[model samples]
Target: MTPPTLMSMMIAGGLIGLGLALLVIWFTPAQPDLNDAVKRLSNTSPHRPDAEASTVNGKERLGIWAMRTLPVGLWAKTPTRELALLRIPLARFYGDKLTYAALGFVIPIGLATFLSLLGLGLPFAMPVIACIALAVVMFFLPNYNAIDDAKKARIEFNRALGAYIDLVALERTNGSGVRQAMETAAGIGDSWVFNRLAEELNRSRWSGLPPWDALHALATELGLPDLDDFADIMRLSGEEGTATYATLRARSAAMRTAMLNDELTEANAIGERMSIPGSLLGVIFMAILLTPSLLRMIPG
Candidate 1:
């Protein structure tokens, strides 16, 4: 009797919860000021142009809590999402985006389940499943975009660095001391890399550190081995005001060649990777076409 009574209470509580959820989902009034708030935030945060400032759940708060408590949430949320996202590793790779997605999906699913149980005239199971599927897609999409953006940024920076080096090397070959050449080249640079180099040089000049040393520090900070190597050579060349026009020219050429080779190698590698998927798709299509014939060969 006690066990039966407890079960009855649990069912009753679930029913009540579901009813309230449906009411919120179907009849909850939209916030009148939400559009204005979204417009204001969109104007301010270029990073979040399409981002809503306030949902029923604030995105910022959701992101902060989710990222900080991801490990805990991973352990707690045991659903289709756990299975799908685990397979994709989207949560581990893109915690912030995946968390927002999970939040969005879970809110809808919770509401749908509640409405269904509350006898709301809506298809609960289908809507809940669709929400989960949408969440899975959203979780991975941002990671893909972020990875692409990072790759493009690195490529652009590398190109800028190469041009800056060529300019410095040219000035070095024109009889300027290594320090003087670097300053001249930086001044003449028509790009952002040169601008940054100039800024670092200025700091070094004011702080009484050698310009080459400043370049080395900047290289270390930027993880730029090419710039670091150039700085080392310039440091050595500066000791006796040695002219390294030939060496600088050769290195500049080599760096450009290496950059070209690297780009070609990456392109070829991507092509090879794409071929594997295309081949798999071809095999799958062939199998589908031959399925009837293969079935006919088997004794049913």
Candidate 2:
């Protein structure tokens, strides 16, 4: 075939492929009903239980569609434990992964087309390889992001719990019983972590379960070990009628110390990372300074 005919055919093929992609996207199936999943997980709709639910937007909706339509389950296992810790739904997590993976797959196609139009043709296999590699990275990007978010959340929860412990100790010193102290302390803070604790305490009260038991269950579900320890202390106080004020005060102090230690450790690690680029810059400067001297010493 003549070059003109071949180029025209390629352009036509590209346009047709683009049109088919757009058509598929436009006809993508609606997201499956997540009500049952929500109810089973939290006994509440996605919106009512937390503030995070209120922030759902278009991208999340797209993710929901992807999650429903794509067979992601065959290869990618849902990070259920991490998602629970982050207070993210499994559906949302899967949806996010799908959205990112779709972007990964689409971006290379657009790039290749742009390059080809600019007279910079890549090998036939290059775009295919790039798409697969990018898609895999993007697919797991959400999981890494979720892990980091969960870590920060756990840190915030521990900080808040430390304050909560002190508040509980103060309430105990004011002559409240264990349950009363926990509920009162939880009620005193307006933070979301406090809100969660208060909700669990209220649930326990309504269900006639011990406050500590509720806390233990919440801790287990959310993977908060410090909260579990706090629950253990409360359990001891309730079961043995032991003097808990001193113990709570001690635990609160220990938690504050531990939190401080964690902050220092993280800060030091960050500083170490920041120094690396500066060190590299210094080495590069030294190399530049020495290059002329070394060249002069070399024989012509």
Candidate 3:
């Protein structure tokens, strides 16, 4: 067999093994342990791991241990900034990467063993290469996930910030101080974005730092330049005694317009992409209808 064909078979076998593993995990029920029994007797609930199985949890623990033993630089290329935006712990991220890598490494080995049992021998190089390639691919899954999640989160946060700017402007127009306006505006909204704003403002209040500084720091950490500009506006309002009601309202309106334009652009691009398949189908249909007529015209 060709190298490409052998590699395809190995990859397919690994995928099949992964599917079987998932099915087994899905159908298997957790057995009660002595600790669970004692907890039930005492009317106290036993804590469950968020992972689907204790074995998976054990794998995560192994991942953690391996990460601690391995060089931190080994995982230095990960999405640390995006992870900060998403508030994922470094250890947990590393653990997830390791768990995925372990699965990728083991699946091919298991497939090789199964093939051997059936008297079909694969070259040692095939499974080895497949294992390494898949492991590398799996290890980066969490990085991609963090980037995508942070991207969506930033969009939501920016949408909320436009309203937040308007709310703060309204509060300022009511004769509230800069700090009071920020706190009151943050309290008015019930979204998680507002909760984050409230938390940061409260932290700044406790730490004796200016609210604008805290906001600026948060913006820098989360890559929200809109929030950073808002912080600068608030800073001017607080330190220089400038009126920001008009400025804040203007900024909010501009942000809303930008967001709307972005949505329209994305929709247009999607429609353009979707037209390709429709155009292809139309061409295929026209060809089918004309093929017999063209053949008859040829006078066979």
Tell me the spans in candidate 1 whose CA falls farther than 4 Å from its real position.
Answer: 1-152
Best lDDT among the predictions, by candidate number: 3
What is candidate 2's lDDT per residue for 1-300, written digit by digit as tens? Answer: 754345446645865885676456556654546664466465222122355664545555655656666676643666665687667766567667766877787688778777777878777677779878998999899988988888889889999999999999899889999999999999999998899888888878876888898888888777888999999999998999888888888888898998889889999999999999999999999999999999999999
Model 3: per-residue Cα lDDT over 117-168, one tens digit each:
6768788798899889999899888888999999999999999999999999
lDDT of 1 by residue, 237-300 (tens): 8886656666677777887888899989999999999899999999999999999998999998
lDDT of 2 at 88: 75
Estimate candidate 1's alpha-carbon lDDT, on a 0 to 1 scale.
Answer: 0.60
Error of 2 at 286 (Å): 3.5
Model 3 TM-score is 0.77
Backbone clash pairs for candidate 2 read none
- If scored against the real structure, what TM-score would every candidate get? 0.53, 0.81, 0.77
The Cα error of candidate 2 at residue 165, in Å, is 0.4
* lDDT score for residue 161 of model 2: 95
